[model samples]
Target: MFAVPALSGADDGSWMEVRSADSRECIMAEQRDERLGRRRLHLRLRFLAGESTGSYVTRLAARNNLPVEGVLRSMGIGPMLPVEPQYTEMYLSRYARERLANLAGYTVAEMQKRLVGLRDEFLMSDGDKDDWEWPWDARAGYIVQACSLCAAQRGTRSPAWLILPDPWHVCLRHHRWTDNSRSTQHPYIDLSNLKDVVRAQQRLNRLGKHLGPAARWVFADACSILVRSGYLEDPARTEEWAALAKQLGEQRVRPLAQLSRLSLLTQDLAWLEVRRLYGELGQADYREWLERATRRHGFTFARPLKEWHSQHQPLSRGIPELFSDQSPPSNVVRRATGHELPSCLAAVEELSCLPWVRLPNTMDRLFL
Candidate 1:
């Protein structure tokens, strides 16, 4: 049996007894909580070691007579080991926590207790610890990796994938915000050039804090819809669009904007849209929302709803799902920028949030 080395400078001290057998060096891990529901687990190991973490876990498992998965699970790491670690290390989703018990001197249980206490880390509920698996299920969950700025500041490269209680789009510390881009990853957009957009993000944060999670979820949903409505381009299109644009700028109109745009009045507009959607969505059905979205985008589906796939499906997903707690997809998120938007989202927020209200009970009958 391979024996763990005895501690030299105080058994449970911050500094551990490092015992190297050839090129394999002992890696240490500890949990650091910087935010709610997303504490970071730092693994202090010579990543230069020739072997993969999975190989190390497998070797340890072979040495200890425990299954490789058991070794990882005990450390709060992943289950099915991967040959190479994925880039999604920032959040709770990554699961490679086993390195914390590097010393053979301590038991796995003891090391976990140490991890829980090290950062004064605790969430309201740790409930149903995640089972790390491939092909993640989208209906019930989401995975957000760590903020780039946070990882860079801390010099951590292997951040875990985490399931945040609410969707967060930026690292306020770095003043960098991100969501889905035109590509796969959530690339950070430096907000340094736009002071107003920065204020807008801050206001959104405050709105979330003041109203609580459910309300914030509703508001983000509203923002996503408003951005998609193309009302931002509507003012340039027709007299009807121009009239509404004039009305939005009028003193009598209300201010409304969300993740799509940031302004002094972002908070009020978010709140307004949230209430607006909650009421309208509560009363409206999903079918109408889908059909109206098609008309708004200046297109209509040629086939039946169920037969509609990629092209038409994009227009159909947000409204019904918005009322639910689940996070919306990339199409809905508007990464704030200097681009001009509607003078007031008040005119368009609800139009996007619940377009079903404006539509007739059926699709246009033969253009009659």
Candidate 2:
């Protein structure tokens, strides 16, 4: 049995040493012993930013030329059933985490900070007890491949999968686009020919920064409005995304790529509508601004604007209630009360309940 070294504190960084064994001995011992409670692998792989636990483990196993299941099993971690080890997250107990950290030459704190999957509270068990089983039915987040160019820069030849929650997959540095598909077959779309899409992504990033927690809701609302207004389906507006699809050898334009453009065009107006809901702006002023904004994009909002007015006009304007036979529900009254804007949380809750509005699936899965 190989002697286990004491882990020093995270500050001094000396806890990484896993007994001074030579390469041949380390490999032989790791293979010979089914339980690697005190043994460490010969290679110490670095964790990529936002990389999932599955990705890190896969990389570690690949670097050391060992089976991923073997590495996992050796550390007292095993799946509840047969699973694609690289695609699913590994839930770990405290002792399992410490063993993993020791194997990867990272302190527990460092592992928690660097690995995105480690932060999930559901996957983490309490106490010093070493529970080795991964739940078979636990809902796993989608993991997609990171930018190939970025992965190459990090000295990895294999694709690095990440748990990215961003609505769009754009690598600004390489100008490559990947969709939020779980399938790994599609190649990254080149954004060099689609400059508008690139610019829209940049604007979307800025919008996220400006709106903070409300940004996803605001963007979803914008998408819903644009789809309802027929702006996103217009031939002229969709031509760019169609061209991009053709360039990328896809049969059809991805709805998300097209929606990204439409949302960017109308996000400012969506935010204005939010302000109007909060009573920050008068109904008349908001209508006027909406008219100007739509006109700038060569869209006349005559019918759509009128419909919007009828649906959302303040109750103080004496518009008849949708259900005139009875008093409005308290939630409806709360949402539509004049100059009494609902809090952000209330607004989100109300918007989510609207049957006609459809948010992107990604937003629904993640933020909602």
Candidate 3:
């Protein structure tokens, strides 16, 4: 068994209930050590006379670098502590196991929820399963953030039919997919069957509200592919709908309208302004055009992103290249892996050559 400091709040010496020291501080110090290229630390801490017993215990834990797992192990505990079932589980048990216990029945969504929740409980909590030490990965946070944005705007108004978190949203967010196998198991959503279709359609309906006139085709194409791939197998009449879908493609419907509006021509000040207006749309290229055009106008932009480039820069040296009144650049794509703009003008362009416009040095410096 691991050894832990026998610090306790209870008179009975039930020390395990005590929380560890400033977990944040300890983690920061560990980071600092790594930054300074140091490996091991020999830390010593002293308890103040005025410090509360709880604070003292926590300080001891931090000084020893003992984690929750370490403390639990020292107490001879197998950390797989079960928690009180949440409302969903209780309801599931009541309907699926108790009331309908005689019958073999379980909803797909309900089963999916239970599987994910249990897996998350294991990863997020100690063996006692009461406390959670959520691990953070820049990548996982990004995925979660994306999931949240998608979830938030889910039914509001978006062309994308469904942004279902693949297989396991929770596991992805926590970044412990290896320990949580449920994420990989339910990879593709089952949209072919009746019940699953209803669920899928419901999700699409929420997403459909956000669809711009131009984005309709992309949505249609995605649906067509799903059906053709047997993921959306429909037993009803099929050819009747196929012709209608073909006609839609011929008309350049759905995604065409939105696509047309996303012109690549950089010279169009109107387009550039539109891109920069929302601060959200038009992706990186929009920002690029905005910066170049704004700088060319002889006004240095500082409030948003600090920039020094002017019309003197190579990209801006010539007549501004107005975005062609056509489709968005074929290369301009939404993120596939992470949230970072992988290879946009913002990433590749140099800013060192650009001069920083400074105010005249004056009375402010004279005092020194």
List the candidates' TM-scores in order.
Answer: 0.36, 0.62, 0.17
**Which candidate, 2 or 3, would have the higher TM-score against the true structure?**
2
CA lDDT, candidate 3, residue 337: 10
Comparison by TM-score, 1 against 2, better one: 2
Q: Tens-digit lDDT track for model 3 on 1-368?
A: 22333434553332234333444211111011112212122443332211111222223334556543332222222222221111011112111111111111333343334233222222332333222222221111111111222322322111111111111121122221111111223222222332332433344433334322112222323222222233222222245334433643312111212111111111132333323322333346744764664454334222212232122122222111212334333233221111122211111111112222111111111111
lDDT of each: 0.33, 0.53, 0.25
Error of 2 at 108 (Å): 3.9
Q: List the residue pairs that clash in candidate 2.
A: none
Q: Tens digit of lDDT per residue, candidate 1, span 52-100?
A: 2232333344445554444443444222323222211111222223233
For all candidates, the clash counts are 14, 0, 29
* Model 2 regions more than 4 Å off: 1-42, 80-82, 85-90, 93-95, 124-141, 166-168, 180-186, 231-252, 256-260, 269-288, 296-354, 357-368
Model with the higher lDDT, candidate 2 or 3: 2
- Best to worst by lDDT, what's the order? 2, 1, 3
State the weakest 10-residue window (summed lDDT) of model 3. Answer: 358-367
